[model samples]
Target: MSIEIFDGIFRYGAMTLLLLICVFLLRSHRSIWPGRLGASAALCTAAYLGCTVAEQDWVILLLLPACIANSVFVWMFGLSLLKERFRPGWPHWGLMVLILTTGLWRKFFADADQMIPVVLEWAHQFIIMGMALHLLWVAWSGRANDLIEARRRFRLYFIAFTPVTMIAIAVIDLWLTPDVAPYFLMALQSFSIWVFAMVILLQAVQLVPEVLFFPAVVLEKNLPNVVSAVDQIAARDLATLNAWIEARDGFFETGLTIRNLGDTIGIPEHRLRRLINSEIGFRNFNDFLNHHRIEEAQKRLLDPTLARLPILTIAMDLGYGSIGPFNRAFLERAGQTPSRFRLQMPPGSS
Candidate 1:
């Protein structure tokens, strides 16, 4: 009959279900740490839920365990994603402003007589939503170059969980009024249970990433290798390397690309991308391809052997659909205009 009794039952049931599922997963899978982390986070959720049902005198004690769990969840989920993408800075600070302001408005003005507890509820929702939103943004920025699968998974979590958690918080906040039997809180709690269930199911179904189990590697600032890693992702392949070289040779072929070449070699696009980055060290995929195209163009221009050929003919031959991009690429690699370079070369010179 009492709210304390009701909340306690709800929290215990939720925690029990999550723990059982975690135990099942750990048993089914050989991997240990991810399961442990998931269990830890679930336990934290249980503790926080228990806090909701605790007497005012016992609230702080019950909440402490959950707080530790929440912090751990943030770190563990975000550890692999902590490059420039998720590092706390302008975007996070800006999002924090939204959360704090919402708390201030809900606590200070929404229901003044019920301010303290309402504010607490709002603050709880604020923190969860803020984290969810931040992680979503991180996933988005991470996906800018290509749709990496891990990023898609993180984005799904942010989108699916954050709103459910926010709704639950709001329900508990509104339940402060005596006329309400706190159906909102109950509904919200149910949704929270559902969200966790989905997360458990998803983890069970999805392929675990290598990074998820690997010992963490800390990257240092000012390491040249950092930039090199990025470049290798962009450039480092011989076929990719040769593609650029052949393009510069002024071989005119429409729709030439890594994909076409990859198909020819029976390699996938991702593998080709890796080859370009690791084997050749190019920061730009298209640029790497174009550089070789331009070089070939330049040679033909400078070569007395091919000096008599028209620039348009050469441009088309080299994969340039137009003279403009070809000339620009030529100047970038050769440090001068193609015509200028051609004219400067002696009659018998290469």
Candidate 2:
């Protein structure tokens, strides 16, 4: 078979697999975001492959829409970082409309200047890169830490890395000469489609019912042993856990670190980290500390007797080195600034 025909077969085969996975995820997953994002990614991959095979100016038309769809998908993922459900603000929609209109004008009616298309391509690349980086930062900084373990793992492993790889591939495509384009296309197609397929499959497995096809009696029989093992492990740490709780007020010690806390509780640092993350439901160490500190600060802020106390003084007493961090954490947890919260408190609240 000719090399061109072989490439076509491989590209189409990958695209077909991706499409099937997207469909399966759409059917099985509860959230529509994953399905929609997967569909957009598949379509974007197909469009790029089509443009590569045809090598025609008209293919730019297909490529432009694909880019637009992928941009929306990236925006959706970015939103997922901030909240469980998000409605895209006007700025997002406005940017989409602007990109589409500019693309059409450049493709159909603009002057024969090559610079315009180059500029447009770079603009789209910048936007994609920004969204990708934002998603990665959210993952790396533990903004998604509150997610269940399965979803958290998925976000970190697949969602965080995909865009970095995509952006690298795009950069390679932009800079490489035509002589190397075909090889790059082949590699990009094979790697991206397979990676996506594997990620979706893993996610599907995670979403499966825990008991699967097992009979209830068998599951019940196995459940006790599993529960017993977990309980035993937890029980072993009971003393350390109790010590940590008894010293909870010590969380307000300035410059306190997890290592210090672990030492105080007589548990190793790694073990302490695991305990807090898995059992206590805290993803970030600072978040765990802030939980207690913020609660104490809120009580002080609302107390009429302490109403005369300055916010800065309250922040310092809570182990925050500065008022800025204290205010931000308070606003995040309480949905208002300390001052605003205090104003809304009942006049004689104790």
Candidate 3:
């Protein structure tokens, strides 16, 4: 009885908190993708929790659509955090539609066939596990090279372990629950949901990072103050580092790493990381190199002498081993493939 009472209290409290979080995010940062996606996730969670408490079937009926989309919103939110120019393409929307369709089918037509429900249940679980694994992959990728301190921390905490917890809850609800589960077990599940809600509420309220809402474009507006922004490095030392990197002794190395670059330049790796993040306006080491490589590629593409040069040769000359990485980096930075970019530019224009 006591557990049930506490469970009800926590669940209700969490729902209220999630609503507040959604409201705050909508009011404060709705113009940004991360804020909007975070609010969507919060609302979905609140609706999901509400379904458990609602006595009326009509209430569940209305809230069910929103509730079933929790994972999709989470995955989108993580992507927004990763890249600044994230757009919800067909794949993202398609997955959402599939999740919604399956959910509504399972809820409305669940009893039509035993086999159908079983298949739907397994499909739903698979989708969830896939999303969880993707989020984990997204969080872990480029973590060491991530220069944004707050975002790195956010990935480590909210984006990393939270998905694992969600996966565990999903497994328990799907297959592990007995035919006649104990009341305490039920209470435990409710409490876990409440705790998940609480964690998101904290993050929404600026617990993890206020910069979580900052646009990636803002990071490129100005160069960092060498002495002020980077405490360990001085102005002259920075000039030397800049000169060395700009001269292409190491940036063009085929298999360059931050540690290797730092060792060559006689700077500590962490300080080098800070310098790139602050002074260079890049969040990743590879991004910094890609910026130089792509710039060189553009110049070469526009040169009359290189007009007949194969794109692969240009990519190889620019220190990229093959065309694939070069094309991907070029497309990401220039918004077009290398061939298209070359064709767009007049010969010898740049």
lDDT of 3 by residue, 1-350 (tens): 59779878877887888788889889998998888998898899889777756778899888988878887887787777776456778999999999999888987888965888778877987898888888788778757667677767777785645678668757865775334556576667667767766776676667766346666532332243233434445555577677775687866778677788878988888777767776666776777778778877898888877778888998888789888999989998889998888887764553
lDDT for 335 in candidate 1 is 79
The order of the candidates by TM-score, greatest first, is 3, 2, 1
lDDT of 2 by residue, 1-350 (tens): 66566666667776676667656656664255545555555566666555555566667665757645555555554454333333456876777677666656665776766688777767756766776676676666553333234444555674556667657755764566345766646655555656665655555455532211111111121221221125665645645565555466576888887778768767777666666655555555676667767877888988888878899999999899998989988986788999899897786664
What is the model-wide C-alpha lDDT for candidate 2?
0.61
Quote the lDDT for 13 in model 1: 65
Question: Which candidate model has the greater TM-score, 2 or 3?
Answer: 3
Of the candidates shown, which would achieve the greatest TM-score relative to the real structure? 3
Q: What are the models' TM-scores?
A: 0.43, 0.66, 0.86
Winner on lDDT (1 vs 3): 3
What overall lDDT goes with each candidate model?
0.53, 0.61, 0.76
TM-score, cand. 1 vs. native = 0.43
lDDT of 1 by residue, 1-350 (tens): 76556654555667676666566546654254555555555556566555555567557454754543453354344433322212244654454455445544553456667656566665656566556556556545544232234544555565566544644454454446323546545545745665665565455555544223233222222221232334543434443435544343332466566566566655677766555444444333455556556756766777777767888889888787888978877776677887887887785664
Candidate 1 positional error at 137, Å = 1.4
Model 3 whole-model lDDT (C-alpha atoms): 0.76
- Model 1: worst 10 consecutive residues (lDDT sum): 216-225
Ordered list by lDDT, greatest first? 3, 2, 1
Off by over 4 Å in 2: 1-6, 28-63, 75-109, 130-163, 176-180, 183-187, 207-229, 236-239, 253-260, 283-287, 310-332, 348-350
